[model samples]
Target: MRLPLPALLCCTAASLLLLLLRWRRRRGLWKKVRAARQRQERSLVQMEMAVQRFREQHPSVNVTSILNLPLPELTEKLRDGSLPLEHVFYAYVGKALQMATETNCITEYLQESETQVQKAKPAGKLGLLYGVPVSLKDSIDCQGHDTTLGFIKNINKPVAEDSVVVQVLRRQGAIPFVKTNIPQSLISYDCNNLIFGQTFNPLLYTRSPGGSTGGEGALIGGGGSILGFGTDLGGSLRFPAAFCGICALKPTGNRLSKKGVVSGIRGQKAVAAAVGPLAKDVESLALSMRALLCEDMFSLDSSVPPLPFNEEVYSSTKPLRIGYYETDFFTMPSPAMRRAIRETKQLLEDAGHTLVPFELMNMDYTLFNFCVKGVFADGCASFLGNFKGELEESSLGLFWLMKSPNWLKNVLSWITKPFMPRLSAMLLSVRANTVDEVWSLHHEIEEFSQQFVAQWKKLNLDVMLCPMLGPALGIGYPAKLSVAVSYTMLYNALDFPAGVVPVTMVTDEDEEELKGYQGYYRDYWDRTMAKAFHGSVGLPVAVQCVALPWQEELCLRFMKEVETLVLKNNRLI
Candidate 1:
């Protein structure tokens, strides 16, 4: 049965050739990575020169005083001609550039913003956001800037036209000053990519400033930008806001248009993505939302409903019934996160608001069946398609899970079924689904959404308060804790309007208690949680406020209430 000498020699030569080819491909990918870094470096240098030139041209502008003014007051000043529009723009741009240098949060949009500043002269009547400097997430398209979404392949592909949201912001006199960084493929909670490097938390550099809205979080949290916009599918906006101690609103999917936001799964609608604002205060978020959800947005994209921000509902002073929960059943929140929810509930109750204990029905099944299964029914082929042969480090975990051969996955599931039942179940569930399976998954999602709404109605609640996915996770935690996104993903699955307001910070006491914490499942995720909060002291913790779909104004009102209480008590300034 032994092969002839010549045949064996031929096989060995073929194997060597294949190895050489693989090495060549890897070398090319690394070259692309280096080229991208160099390009970004050049852009940053050019931006610095532009900023210096601006500083020399406007010597007596008092940039510090301009940044001190809040968004509302700043708008009024700009309207009355007390503050020059160019001065206001440069003030924010200067602060933004400083923060971006420290955290690596900005992409290449400075030169374009300089042009925008020149074009922002006030007319007779000031627009809602006149002279305001607004930041945008990387995926949001600006006509001349590249919407990379942190992909090496998408580095130089400048979007030819602005997204509908950007156009609307401009129409309202908001200057789109900068584009922020994001996680690769805009999916993981950790924000790192080869294109722009990793964006660090301004408060704590060791931990993540959650993604894919992470760049916005760091800049706004660092007091660099007054308001910024980010898109969310699974906690992208809320998680970062919580981690960075800022305010953000994830409105119902249709409320804000998503016309030109670059997404990996752009066509996937099983769980729709939403564009929302992140800002320093709840009022700023409200202002941005009002400007974003306008007739202009609807006119550009007919899919957007012509629903304006309801002022009356947002200003309601009636006593409210609020449902509250500490955990979402998939993962137990950290001590600081749980404390944030408990304290917010206590504050609302003391403020004449009624609080009721609430639990999500079949949360575990809903997350796995609808959110997870529905989004990845095609085994993440669509999500992976945008990488263009370069795989980001953060995406390797989910990528491997989705790309593994069926036989290997089955074997792993079988082996782990005895001891690691939870993981075994997940392994079995992650795979390429059929057309019929996808359809059935969508049907189940509809049923689940209806059931959730019915449950809410039965409770007769005005709003619900819950914890975000633990306190801002430490660096490199998202790859291991992928399933821990259940809390925020639940809202997305139900299409609810959710907002996050910082209530407390992670203290030594919170970290000490987490050391002995035992999660509900006591599984791999729980173990990961235990280790993730070790160096997380002093990180901000926030709670989520949610309302039924299209009730964003109500959601913002509740967030404002919580924010006011937190500020008055000096719990968070």
Candidate 2:
């Protein structure tokens, strides 16, 4: 095998060149990356062109004041002839497109928005929403737009009908303006996919706007859309709301119709995604909830309950017995999150609302046994299968557990036990394989729900103050700390009506505290979490409000109270 030095060098150089060529070839193909890029470019171009055409056809008007005006005031002005539907529609359309440019937040702007605005009745003739423009999360079906949910395979196929929520919005005279971006299948909190690239936080380009409704979060946060409707299976709505410094409500599942929504695998009802609103303010969210839980929605979707908004519960001046928890114990509360909670808890107490200490025990167990298993009963084959013959976004790296064998997970769980007990425990938590195991998982979730309800009743809690995920983790960190969803995912599992209200911003001290964070387990998860909040200063911190099943109005009332208290005052306490 011996060869001259010059001959060996020539052979090695030839091999190196061959390897480089092969690498470049793979990158060139990129598993449909080129097609996805072209699609995104076309979508954005169409949006810009539509906005430009609308501007050309309609006379220009100052929408600054209209944009600043809250939902209630805007609607009132429209009804009183002080504001025109044309101006409001254009204001949102232009701003949404602009925000999309800055943040990559929107998926596709609706072409029929102009038509919707033109046909709209004048001055309160239509409905409660009267000419208000609304943005929808990408998963909510729009008749002519493709709800890709970040999959290339799902592209170019427009829906045949409007999602029930969209129909409800139209019936209320609300124009669905645009469909926002989302992470493909919500494998991570940060929104990114091959189809639409990534959605950066409008507040800070480097930070992530939580998802899968994150596009709505960034768009609304950037003042593009004042009110938007989104869904939450596992904090999809709340995460974005918190990250983007906005308000949102995740109503109990089945409260709003999900008939036409394009979400998880068909017929997989492990954990139902509830549709609700993300708004500039809590009152707007209340209004949205009121509008959605109306007869229009009830009549349109037979699957939903025939329950209208209970004005009495929402408007009641009575004090509430509130339960609160500063930490979920699974993920250590960030300094900003802790402060938001304590301050809100203080404000609630000062407002004569009782704040009882409520602890969320066994979150890791709950997260795995209930949420993860329930959502991925089939070991996530249905989810992973979607990515077949497709380019996968990097955010899905952590979501590859199902691809691994049971023996491997068991071996990893056993191997990592000593050093990373939390990780080991998670690995040890197996997914449902057979139908019998699936039924058992369902029974377990029911039992857990019953137990949670029992505890809520035992505490006599009218509402609860919760620590929300916030201060916008750096990009890619949310996925790394996926289990850190302890705060919001708990509600999703319990099917409670949870809402996020921005209370305060991260301060210098909060940053210091964040730097000093040590996870409860003191494992990699803890250290990674500390590292995750590296650049969290000045970002908005929010507190979550949770209410019992079907008590959305009361939840809104509680959210409004927290928002009011936070805005009112809380001097050196």
Candidate 3:
């Protein structure tokens, strides 16, 4: 088949051109496949490692010994010098290390924490939270620890200075032993990442701990550590506390220092995030808040108002009126949660306090506007920027737009109509609004805030009691519908002082009742909620106590009263 030299050269050239194009196409496809497979492999390895670590970390540790000793008892031991700072530090550090191994709750453990114990002063000079081991979410800066916030690329970067809270905690002699887990971008409710992996509920390994403060919740909730720090803009603290049955507060924005805290959305001032604590009990949460509020944080950052912890607010002895609601404006709470709210109201009323029913103004509009737009207004680019690898499935629920195909996503409004009616309607409602629209929403938020204050004044209430949301949700359920957290996020928008206190535990009866549920709306939200509420039996149920802004002391006092009433009435305390 020998041919002329010119024809042979032409055929060889054509063959080479085709080979080059094919090689480029194959390379691109392989890269995509490799990325997808790597993501899955990493997730599986993380999950397996978490399980293995849990088994190895606490082989002989007495979980009961740690649980039996409450914070007050620990404090007494520390005060009398019976328990050295090292003893307290070791006990919690040991437990936290164990919990972190099992649950993957830690992003960074301070290997040099013993140095903190060795340098601790005697009891006379120690402040309120002295010798206590407090963990911070990875997002908050602590000197000498990398505030990775769960990004692998951030692992090598160490923080140069401590955040304001870290400095305050150190001044009080609290050992910052570990940096707890958080979501990849701190945007989703679920806590999972490629770097530190997923943070599971210590109570139930399969379930979420809640985030962006989920690690704080898991560590404290599991009794691995007590009196930990967490931040909340939209229920980041409250949601995890509620899910794990721990107590927490989301103080009014700017009331707590936001400086030196690392976040994906650094300059998002529209809905400000406030740093606070997650603790084992109500007293712990109060004490932690008081400690942070000592001398006021405004000095460190002038943006914060120079208001000290208003002492007068806590002096009221009156059995004040309280408003109770089972659900927020957006979603009706699960039956067990509603039951918890009703039970709490009955307990309070029986204790000689007035109980009234109240509804948040345009709860639906407020929730849709503030949460969807205000939080993700930057189009999640900021959040996605932190990820050098593939997105975790737990986070996809938050940034839903990322996975959608362009043509289908573009014409979603049209496709939504009559196709998947229930979901269709929700998509139309939840579609992100324009920046100008978000600005208007922000103004409306201010108006809503004023109206909320007016409503509180009209009620003349000391504290309003409500459910934190449904009972302890099923494991992995938070990934399904985190939007339900609006119940807690609503207060954050109002910048009110709200505390979550565990009131009851979900029971068989609650599950049986939930099965017979019937709501007027047959929307997708309703059906999805119904399914999610099914397996959430036998978990803790908690109530949220809310008061006016800067009234944290008053809110805690009222919370104790309600706690006392519930305990005395049920004889559970």
Instruction: Report lDDT (CA) for all predictions.
Output: 0.84, 0.83, 0.72
List ranges where model 2 is wrong by over 4 Å.
Answer: 1-60, 430-432, 570-573
RMSD of each: 2.4, 4.7, 6.1
Tens digit per residue, CA lDDT, model 2, 494-529? 888999999999898988777678979998778888
| Residue 235 in candidate 3, Cα distance off native in Å | 1.3
**Model 3 per-residue lDDT at 83:** 62
Query: In lDDT terms, which candidate is top?
Result: 1
**TM-score of model 1 (CA atoms):** 0.94
Compare candidates 1 and 3 on lDDT and give the better one. Answer: 1
Q: lDDT by residue for model 3 over 1-573, one digit each (tens)?
A: 898999999999999999998788656545644553354345335534543454475466444564557777776678678765655565676577678767878766665566777777674566777888888888999887677665555655778999988888888777887778888668767787765667888877766787789999999988888888888877788878878888888888777787878875676656667888888777777777767776635667787777766556665677888887777646777777888888888887777889988876656566656655566555544555566443333354535754344344447747866655434433444444577876887797788889887887798876788778755455555666756767777877778888888878778888888887654355655667787667666677788888888778888888777667767777754
- List candidate 1 stretches off by more than 4 Å: 1-29, 391-398, 571-573
What is the full ranking by lDDT, best candidate first? 1, 2, 3
Residue 226's lDDT in candidate 3: 80
Candidate 3 positional error at 457, Å: 1.9
Q: What is residue 357's positional error in candidate 1, in angstroms? A: 1.1
